[model samples]
Target: MTDTHTPRGLAETYFLCWRRRDFTDLAPHLADEVAFDGPLASVRGREDCLEGLVGLARATTHLEVERRLVDENDVMTWFSLGVGGSEPTPVVNWCHVEDGRIRAIRVAFDPRGILAAG
Candidate 1:
Protein backbone atom coordinates (compact mmCIF):
# COMPACT_ATOMS: atom_id res chain seq x y z
CA MET A 1 0.00 0.00 0.00
CA THR A 2 2.70 2.46 -1.00
CA ASP A 3 3.26 4.68 -3.95
CA THR A 4 6.35 3.93 -6.06
CA HIS A 5 7.72 7.41 -5.31
CA THR A 6 8.20 6.85 -1.62
CA PRO A 7 10.77 5.04 0.49
CA ARG A 8 8.20 2.60 1.81
CA GLY A 9 7.26 1.86 -1.73
CA LEU A 10 10.83 1.08 -2.61
CA ALA A 11 10.97 -1.36 0.26
CA GLU A 12 7.72 -2.91 -0.87
CA THR A 13 9.26 -3.33 -4.28
CA TYR A 14 12.19 -5.08 -2.67
CA PHE A 15 9.79 -7.31 -0.78
CA LEU A 16 8.03 -8.10 -4.00
CA CYS A 17 11.36 -9.14 -5.45
CA TRP A 18 11.99 -11.24 -2.39
CA ARG A 19 8.65 -12.97 -2.85
CA ARG A 20 9.52 -13.65 -6.45
CA ARG A 21 13.12 -14.58 -5.66
CA ASP A 22 14.43 -12.09 -8.17
CA PHE A 23 16.79 -9.22 -7.32
CA THR A 24 17.56 -7.88 -10.72
CA ASP A 25 15.85 -4.62 -9.84
CA LEU A 26 17.26 -4.28 -6.37
CA ALA A 27 20.69 -2.86 -7.09
CA PRO A 28 19.43 0.40 -8.48
CA HIS A 29 17.41 1.06 -5.37
CA LEU A 30 20.43 0.83 -3.12
CA ALA A 31 23.07 3.48 -2.65
CA ASP A 32 26.56 2.84 -3.93
CA GLU A 33 27.82 2.51 -0.35
CA VAL A 34 24.80 0.99 1.34
CA ALA A 35 25.26 -0.82 4.62
CA PHE A 36 23.58 -4.04 5.73
CA ASP A 37 23.70 -5.47 9.21
CA GLY A 38 22.01 -8.74 10.03
CA PRO A 39 22.27 -11.51 12.55
CA LEU A 40 24.76 -13.40 10.43
CA ALA A 41 26.89 -10.61 8.99
CA SER A 42 27.51 -6.94 8.46
CA VAL A 43 28.36 -5.81 4.97
CA ARG A 44 29.08 -2.42 3.48
CA GLY A 45 28.65 -1.28 -0.13
CA ARG A 46 25.84 -2.16 -2.47
CA GLU A 47 27.54 -5.08 -4.17
CA ASP A 48 28.36 -6.86 -0.95
CA CYS A 49 24.90 -6.24 0.38
CA LEU A 50 23.25 -7.62 -2.70
CA GLU A 51 25.57 -10.60 -2.76
CA GLY A 52 24.88 -11.46 0.88
CA LEU A 53 21.19 -11.00 0.53
CA VAL A 54 20.98 -13.16 -2.57
CA GLY A 55 23.14 -15.79 -0.97
CA LEU A 56 20.82 -16.10 2.02
CA ALA A 57 17.74 -15.77 -0.14
CA ARG A 58 18.70 -18.98 -1.92
CA ALA A 59 17.48 -20.89 1.12
CA THR A 60 14.16 -19.12 1.35
CA THR A 61 10.94 -20.84 0.45
CA HIS A 62 8.59 -17.93 1.12
CA LEU A 63 8.22 -14.39 2.49
CA GLU A 64 5.06 -13.12 4.10
CA VAL A 65 4.80 -9.48 5.06
CA GLU A 66 2.98 -8.64 8.27
CA ARG A 67 3.39 -4.87 8.53
CA ARG A 68 5.38 -1.83 7.46
CA LEU A 69 5.92 1.38 9.38
CA VAL A 70 7.23 4.45 7.69
CA ASP A 71 8.61 7.63 9.25
CA GLU A 72 9.96 10.11 6.78
CA ASN A 73 13.00 8.48 5.20
CA ASP A 74 13.01 5.54 7.63
CA VAL A 75 11.00 2.38 7.08
CA MET A 76 10.58 -0.71 9.14
CA THR A 77 9.06 -3.84 7.67
CA TRP A 78 8.02 -6.90 9.61
CA PHE A 79 7.70 -10.19 7.86
CA SER A 80 7.78 -13.94 8.18
CA LEU A 81 10.67 -15.72 6.50
CA GLY A 82 10.29 -19.36 5.51
CA VAL A 83 13.51 -21.23 4.97
CA GLY A 84 13.71 -24.70 3.56
CA GLY A 85 9.96 -25.12 4.14
CA SER A 86 10.48 -24.82 7.87
CA GLU A 87 8.31 -22.74 10.16
CA PRO A 88 8.58 -19.07 9.38
CA THR A 89 10.76 -16.82 11.51
CA PRO A 90 9.65 -13.31 12.29
CA VAL A 91 11.99 -10.68 10.85
CA VAL A 92 12.22 -6.92 11.04
CA ASN A 93 14.19 -4.77 8.66
CA TRP A 94 14.96 -1.15 9.43
CA CYS A 95 15.77 0.75 6.28
CA HIS A 96 17.20 4.23 6.02
CA VAL A 97 16.72 6.11 2.82
CA GLU A 98 18.83 8.87 1.40
CA ASP A 99 19.11 10.57 -1.97
CA GLY A 100 16.21 8.50 -3.30
CA ARG A 101 18.03 5.27 -2.51
CA ILE A 102 18.35 2.88 0.37
CA ARG A 103 21.44 3.89 2.31
CA ALA A 104 21.32 1.40 5.13
CA ILE A 105 19.44 -1.67 6.29
CA ARG A 106 19.61 -3.39 9.66
CA VAL A 107 17.81 -6.68 10.12
CA ALA A 108 16.71 -8.28 13.36
CA PHE A 109 15.74 -11.91 13.74
CA ASP A 110 16.35 -14.98 15.84
CA PRO A 111 18.86 -17.11 14.00
CA ARG A 112 18.43 -20.15 16.20
CA GLY A 113 15.57 -21.62 14.21
CA ILE A 114 17.19 -20.93 10.90
CA LEU A 115 20.59 -22.17 12.01
CA ALA A 116 19.16 -25.29 13.63
CA ALA A 117 17.23 -26.05 10.47
CA GLY A 118 20.44 -26.13 8.47
Candidate 2:
Protein backbone atom coordinates (compact mmCIF):
# COMPACT_ATOMS: atom_id res chain seq x y z
CA MET A 1 0.00 0.00 0.00
CA THR A 2 1.09 3.51 -0.74
CA ASP A 3 1.53 6.30 1.79
CA THR A 4 -1.76 8.02 2.69
CA HIS A 5 -0.40 11.52 2.10
CA THR A 6 -0.74 11.45 -1.66
CA PRO A 7 -4.11 11.97 -3.33
CA ARG A 8 -4.15 8.64 -5.20
CA GLY A 9 -2.84 6.84 -2.18
CA LEU A 10 -5.46 8.47 0.01
CA ALA A 11 -8.21 7.47 -2.43
CA GLU A 12 -7.05 3.87 -2.40
CA THR A 13 -6.82 3.81 1.36
CA TYR A 14 -10.22 5.46 1.72
CA PHE A 15 -11.83 2.97 -0.63
CA LEU A 16 -10.30 0.06 1.19
CA CYS A 17 -11.55 1.33 4.49
CA TRP A 18 -15.01 1.93 3.05
CA ARG A 19 -15.17 -1.54 1.56
CA ARG A 20 -14.40 -2.98 4.95
CA ARG A 21 -16.89 -0.71 6.71
CA ASP A 22 -14.04 0.31 8.98
CA PHE A 23 -15.08 3.78 10.02
CA THR A 24 -12.20 4.04 12.45
CA ASP A 25 -9.73 3.51 9.69
CA LEU A 26 -11.54 6.04 7.55
CA ALA A 27 -11.54 8.70 10.22
CA PRO A 28 -7.88 9.54 9.91
CA HIS A 29 -8.43 10.63 6.34
CA LEU A 30 -11.04 13.22 7.24
CA ALA A 31 -10.30 16.70 8.48
CA ASP A 32 -11.56 17.78 11.86
CA GLU A 33 -14.01 20.09 10.15
CA VAL A 34 -15.28 18.31 7.09
CA ALA A 35 -18.19 19.03 4.81
CA PHE A 36 -20.21 16.21 3.35
CA ASP A 37 -23.07 16.61 0.88
CA GLY A 38 -24.98 13.72 -0.50
CA PRO A 39 -28.39 12.60 -1.70
CA LEU A 40 -29.80 12.38 1.79
CA ALA A 41 -28.60 15.45 3.61
CA SER A 42 -25.79 17.91 3.96
CA VAL A 43 -23.59 17.42 6.96
CA ARG A 44 -20.60 19.24 8.47
CA GLY A 45 -17.85 18.31 10.90
CA ARG A 46 -16.02 15.02 11.35
CA GLU A 47 -18.44 13.65 13.89
CA ASP A 48 -21.47 14.24 11.73
CA CYS A 49 -19.71 12.82 8.73
CA LEU A 50 -18.72 9.70 10.62
CA GLU A 51 -22.20 9.29 12.00
CA GLY A 52 -23.70 9.57 8.55
CA LEU A 53 -21.29 6.94 7.25
CA VAL A 54 -22.13 4.56 10.05
CA GLY A 55 -25.82 4.97 9.43
CA LEU A 56 -25.32 4.46 5.72
CA ALA A 57 -23.27 1.33 6.26
CA ARG A 58 -26.04 -0.14 8.36
CA ALA A 59 -28.45 0.20 5.45
CA THR A 60 -26.09 -0.67 2.65
CA THR A 61 -24.25 -3.71 1.33
CA HIS A 62 -21.96 -4.57 -1.51
CA LEU A 63 -20.48 -1.12 -1.76
CA GLU A 64 -17.96 -0.83 -4.57
CA VAL A 65 -15.94 2.14 -5.79
CA GLU A 66 -14.51 2.96 -9.19
CA ARG A 67 -11.79 5.56 -9.42
CA ARG A 68 -12.42 8.14 -12.12
CA LEU A 69 -9.82 10.84 -11.58
CA VAL A 70 -6.99 11.57 -9.17
CA ASP A 71 -5.13 14.83 -9.08
CA GLU A 72 -2.92 16.74 -6.64
CA ASN A 73 -5.59 17.31 -4.02
CA ASP A 74 -8.79 16.02 -5.57
CA VAL A 75 -10.33 12.74 -6.55
CA MET A 76 -13.49 11.69 -8.34
CA THR A 77 -14.86 8.29 -7.49
CA TRP A 78 -17.90 6.46 -8.76
CA PHE A 79 -19.63 4.07 -6.45
CA SER A 80 -22.37 1.46 -6.62
CA LEU A 81 -24.27 0.74 -3.46
CA GLY A 82 -26.67 -2.12 -3.00
CA VAL A 83 -29.31 -1.33 -0.46
CA GLY A 84 -31.63 -3.93 1.07
CA GLY A 85 -31.63 -6.29 -1.92
CA SER A 86 -32.56 -3.57 -4.38
CA GLU A 87 -30.67 -2.69 -7.52
CA PRO A 88 -27.18 -1.28 -7.11
CA THR A 89 -27.46 2.49 -7.11
CA PRO A 90 -24.89 4.58 -8.91
CA VAL A 91 -23.24 7.58 -7.26
CA VAL A 92 -20.50 10.03 -8.07
CA ASN A 93 -18.21 11.08 -5.24
CA TRP A 94 -15.95 14.10 -5.39
CA CYS A 95 -13.39 14.63 -2.68
CA HIS A 96 -11.12 17.56 -1.93
CA VAL A 97 -8.20 17.13 0.38
CA GLU A 98 -5.76 19.20 2.42
CA ASP A 99 -2.76 17.88 4.32
CA GLY A 100 -3.71 14.28 3.54
CA ARG A 101 -7.19 14.58 5.01
CA ILE A 102 -10.43 15.16 3.20
CA ARG A 103 -11.80 18.66 3.67
CA ALA A 104 -14.89 18.28 1.52
CA ILE A 105 -16.95 15.61 -0.16
CA ARG A 106 -19.85 15.92 -2.58
CA VAL A 107 -21.91 12.95 -3.60
CA ALA A 108 -24.44 12.86 -6.43
CA PHE A 109 -26.94 10.11 -6.69
CA ASP A 110 -30.60 9.58 -7.43
CA PRO A 111 -32.28 10.55 -4.20
CA ARG A 112 -35.65 9.73 -5.70
CA GLY A 113 -34.51 6.20 -6.39
CA ILE A 114 -33.19 5.85 -2.87
CA LEU A 115 -36.38 7.23 -1.35
CA ALA A 116 -38.73 5.33 -3.65
CA ALA A 117 -37.57 1.97 -2.42
CA GLY A 118 -37.03 2.83 1.19
Candidate 3:
Protein backbone atom coordinates (compact mmCIF):
# COMPACT_ATOMS: atom_id res chain seq x y z
CA MET A 1 0.00 0.00 0.00
CA THR A 2 1.27 3.43 -0.87
CA ASP A 3 1.67 5.78 2.07
CA THR A 4 -1.11 8.34 1.86
CA HIS A 5 1.13 11.20 2.90
CA THR A 6 2.10 12.28 -0.61
CA PRO A 7 -0.33 14.31 -2.70
CA ARG A 8 -0.40 11.69 -5.46
CA GLY A 9 -0.72 8.91 -2.96
CA LEU A 10 -3.52 10.63 -1.11
CA ALA A 11 -5.44 11.25 -4.33
CA GLU A 12 -5.05 7.63 -5.36
CA THR A 13 -5.97 6.42 -1.91
CA TYR A 14 -9.15 8.47 -2.05
CA PHE A 15 -10.34 6.47 -5.08
CA LEU A 16 -9.67 3.19 -3.34
CA CYS A 17 -11.52 4.35 -0.26
CA TRP A 18 -14.36 5.67 -2.35
CA ARG A 19 -14.59 2.39 -4.23
CA ARG A 20 -14.88 0.48 -0.99
CA ARG A 21 -17.07 3.19 0.52
CA ASP A 22 -14.66 3.37 3.42
CA PHE A 23 -15.00 6.82 4.86
CA THR A 24 -12.94 5.85 7.88
CA ASP A 25 -9.87 5.29 5.75
CA LEU A 26 -10.47 8.39 3.68
CA ALA A 27 -11.13 10.79 6.53
CA PRO A 28 -7.56 10.81 7.77
CA HIS A 29 -6.36 11.99 4.39
CA LEU A 30 -8.50 15.11 4.48
CA ALA A 31 -7.65 18.30 6.29
CA ASP A 32 -9.82 19.31 9.23
CA GLU A 33 -10.81 22.42 7.28
CA VAL A 34 -11.17 20.73 3.92
CA ALA A 35 -13.36 22.37 1.31
CA PHE A 36 -15.32 20.69 -1.48
CA ASP A 37 -16.61 22.37 -4.62
CA GLY A 38 -18.48 20.82 -7.49
CA PRO A 39 -21.19 21.54 -9.95
CA LEU A 40 -23.85 19.82 -7.86
CA ALA A 41 -22.74 20.90 -4.43
CA SER A 42 -20.37 23.07 -2.48
CA VAL A 43 -19.36 22.31 1.09
CA ARG A 44 -16.75 23.19 3.67
CA GLY A 45 -15.09 21.36 6.55
CA ARG A 46 -13.94 17.75 6.85
CA GLU A 47 -17.10 16.27 8.30
CA ASP A 48 -19.34 18.00 5.78
CA CYS A 49 -17.03 17.06 2.93
CA LEU A 50 -17.01 13.45 4.04
CA GLU A 51 -20.75 13.48 4.45
CA GLY A 52 -21.27 14.90 0.97
CA LEU A 53 -18.92 12.34 -0.55
CA VAL A 54 -20.68 9.52 1.28
CA GLY A 55 -24.01 10.67 -0.06
CA LEU A 56 -22.55 10.74 -3.57
CA ALA A 57 -21.08 7.29 -3.05
CA ARG A 58 -24.56 5.91 -2.55
CA ALA A 59 -25.20 6.53 -6.24
CA THR A 60 -21.75 5.46 -7.37
CA THR A 61 -21.61 2.08 -9.02
CA HIS A 62 -18.11 2.32 -10.41
CA LEU A 63 -15.11 4.65 -10.62
CA GLU A 64 -12.78 4.19 -13.58
CA VAL A 65 -9.80 6.47 -13.34
CA GLU A 66 -8.21 7.25 -16.68
CA ARG A 67 -5.35 9.51 -15.76
CA ARG A 68 -3.72 11.58 -13.04
CA LEU A 69 -1.51 14.63 -13.46
CA VAL A 70 0.51 15.76 -10.50
CA ASP A 71 2.37 19.00 -9.85
CA GLU A 72 3.85 19.43 -6.42
CA ASN A 73 0.94 19.60 -3.99
CA ASP A 74 -1.72 19.63 -6.68
CA VAL A 75 -3.14 16.52 -8.30
CA MET A 76 -5.65 16.46 -11.10
CA THR A 77 -7.46 13.21 -11.77
CA TRP A 78 -9.80 12.37 -14.61
CA PHE A 79 -12.24 9.54 -14.16
CA SER A 80 -15.60 8.20 -15.09
CA LEU A 81 -18.16 8.16 -12.30
CA GLY A 82 -20.56 5.32 -12.92
CA VAL A 83 -23.73 6.23 -11.12
CA GLY A 84 -26.37 3.58 -10.91
CA GLY A 85 -27.29 1.89 -14.22
CA SER A 86 -26.91 4.90 -16.42
CA GLU A 87 -23.80 5.66 -18.47
CA PRO A 88 -20.83 6.92 -16.58
CA THR A 89 -20.28 10.62 -16.12
CA PRO A 90 -16.86 11.86 -17.08
CA VAL A 91 -15.40 13.86 -14.21
CA VAL A 92 -12.37 15.88 -13.38
CA ASN A 93 -11.34 16.23 -9.76
CA TRP A 94 -8.56 18.61 -8.82
CA CYS A 95 -7.17 18.27 -5.33
CA HIS A 96 -4.87 20.58 -3.46
CA VAL A 97 -2.77 19.02 -0.77
CA GLU A 98 -1.07 20.65 2.16
CA ASP A 99 0.91 19.07 4.96
CA GLY A 100 0.12 15.58 3.60
CA ARG A 101 -3.63 16.11 3.71
CA ILE A 102 -6.14 17.11 1.10
CA ARG A 103 -7.08 20.70 1.85
CA ALA A 104 -9.43 21.41 -1.03
CA ILE A 105 -11.12 19.71 -3.95
CA ARG A 106 -12.73 21.17 -7.05
CA VAL A 107 -14.76 18.98 -9.38
CA ALA A 108 -15.97 19.70 -12.89
CA PHE A 109 -18.49 17.96 -15.13
CA ASP A 110 -21.55 18.50 -17.21
CA PRO A 111 -24.64 17.97 -15.08
CA ARG A 112 -27.20 18.14 -17.83
CA GLY A 113 -27.86 14.40 -18.03
CA ILE A 114 -28.09 14.05 -14.30
CA LEU A 115 -30.37 17.05 -14.03
CA ALA A 116 -32.60 15.73 -16.82
CA ALA A 117 -33.00 12.47 -14.99
CA GLY A 118 -34.15 14.24 -11.86
What TM-score does each of the candidates earn?
Answer: 0.92, 0.88, 0.94
Tens digits of lDDT, candidate 1, 1-118: 3355689888997887776667777778899999999898999998998888887788898788999999999999999998875789999999999988999999999988888877
lDDT of each: 0.86, 0.81, 0.89
Worst 10 residues of 1 by lDDT: 1-10
Off by over 4 Å in 1: 1-3
Error in Å for residue 34 of model 1: 0.3
Q: lDDT of candidate 2?
A: 0.81
| True-structure lDDT of candidate 3 | 0.89
Report the lDDT of model 1 for residue 61: 82
Q: In candidate 2, what are the lDDT values of residues 1-118, reduced to their tens digit?
A: 4478777777777667666666787787899999999878899999999888778777786687755698779889888977766678898888899987999989998876567667
Which 10 consecutive positions of candidate 2 have the poorest summed lDDT?
13-22
Q: Order the candidate numbers by lDDT, best to worst.
A: 3, 1, 2
Model 3 residue 29 CA deviation in Å: 1.5
For candidate 3, write residues 29-79 as lDDT tens digits: 899999999999999999999998888888887789999999999999999
